[model samples]
Target chain A: MSNPNMKLLYVVLALAILISILAPFLASSDPDGLESAAEKIIGEERFTELEEAEAAIDSPMPDYSIEGKGKLGEIIAICLGTIGILAISFGLGKIIKA
Target chain B: MHIPDSFMPLSQALIYWAIALPFIFMSLRWARRDMDEMKIPILAALSAGIFAIQALNIPIGMGTSGHMVGAALVAIIFGSPFAGVLVLTLVLLVQGIIFADGGITVMGANILNMGVISGSIGYYGFVALRKRNIDIKASAFIGAWLGLFISSIAAAIEMSLAGTFPLVPGIVAMGTFHFVIGIIGEGLITAIAIGAIAKARPDLVDDKAVEASKEVTL
Candidate 1:
């Protein structure tokens, strides 16, 4: 079926790819506000300990990158992850509406 | 922001889970009632777009960064705050399990803060403005900012209640930085995206029934 907003869809898809795939490389590798604040409030060591302590679950792409795959791999992992998320969300919505 | 596992007090997590579970149920019912099969693909596409946007963490100086949560964006565009909740919950769940960005145990707290709180705020903010005959695009921009602002405060409160930090300082820290960044990030993204949709497929921008329902306060 032809989408009425096919042009909009293409724009969205292009933007998503650029942000998820290309932009990650350029993004500052700094901790976010909460993490930065947490580090300041409770010394860096403790903060590190807190985050490190939570390594209980073995996530496939921990930290949004495949271990040892470096920059290119990070891009691929994040891109795939993004696509997977969309599929799950759309798939669920489809099933529910069905 | 995604809260880690042990950072959230178990009691607080349980409380948020209790609060958030009902919203999930309610949104499910809303989705069923408000959505038709034809809208599913568009809904999915929008959700996917939001997912990518959330992952893009823009630098806001001071060695701190913030990503677009996109709850407000989703809520405003979809014209259903419930849809926002569901979309955010899905994103957070995916990030939590696949990337370990958030913890499994604290998922409820994350969902409550990032999804329900922000989504409701954005939804109402837009609805309220639209009732006042505000421009749809302008309403969406304001709604996105207000929603993000309020959600940031809520997250700070959660951290305080969990004993991770002092209430006042936590609120100040989160509110200040996020307010500075979230307003611009959320406002521009939502406005631009909605603007694009308005240009390409104007029919989807403002549904009459959704606009009418906006008058009823949450």
Candidate 2:
């Protein structure tokens, strides 16, 4: 017999993935839910106040987006995030089965 | 919302990675018990749900906003499969890469605190509560609330360990903010999801019904 819930779960997961992957391009650049609040009370300068020298570190992949680093970090982030997730799921799936 | 590198110190981020490593190991073992090919889709959908939910970034006091962590939610819906971890991993990666919400170095830590703690510990707590004649609504409420609450404090402690903030203040702030966020978001989500699942698919909702106490054993 076929397992119905599993299939439904798959379709939902796919839809969620496409949305998340496109979130960067699709999302409004405006300050997010919390950022909007922060700007209201503290003004835009307040977020800046939180910044510290520790951010000055010369890491290649400093920010989340593929900023200074070439295609290398971008590939790593995407590949690792996706592949890593898959690997964990598959590998752990095996263990759980054992 | 993602915390940047500047606000949190390297020491704190490093410690997060350290803590996450072991959970990853433990999760692998947990997944081994009931590995089912059918559960993959549920896990994936859960990951996606987490992404969509985290995108909300609802406002809280102190010029901060908290979104749905849903770690416990994932665990409750789906077991300890890497799907919860994967879902959170993707969310953090996107936040770092696209939104600049969270930093790259500490991404693993964020996943551990939000994903692992909530999914594993919180879910297990829910299971334990479920073992007794606990009410479904209360169980869902406690599972999600405690999951986020505990994970947030754990994150704060991890930060303090890494010297992100002064120990006392860090705990006080992250804990307080998350407590509110968890109560509102986790409670609402868990309750609604439980209700919907119970109505639509009682079997899937696990412990949602009153007599669910001994109906099934996962």
Candidate closest to the true structure, highest TM-score: 1
Which residue pairs show collisions in model 2?
A64-B96, A64-B97, A65-B97, A95-B32, A96-B31, A96-B32, A96-B33, B2-B101, B11-B162, B12-B162
lDDT (Cα, 0-100) at B7 in candidate 2: 47
What is the per-residue lDDT of model 2 for residues A1-98, given as tens digits with 9 covering 90 to 100? 38686666555556555544554444344543323433443455755575433443344334324666544544444333443444444454545564
> Which window of ten consecutive residues has the lowest lDDT sum in model 1 chain B?
B209-218
Q: Encode model 1's per-residue lDDT on A1-98: one tens digit a residue.
A: 56564455566667787888875677667787788778777779988988888554779988788888898877887788778876886688767878
Error in Å for residue B100 of model 2: 3.2
DockQ, every prediction: 0.64, 0.20
- Kindly report the docking quality category of candidate 2: incorrect
Q: State residue A53's C-alpha deviation in candidate 1, in Å.
A: 1.5
lDDT of 2 by residue, B127-179 (tens): 77777867666777888888888877776666556554556766676677778
For candidate 1, what is the DockQ-based docking class? Answer: medium
After superposing candidate 1 on the true structure, give the runs of residues whose Cα lies further than 4 Å from its correct spot.
A2-10, B207-218
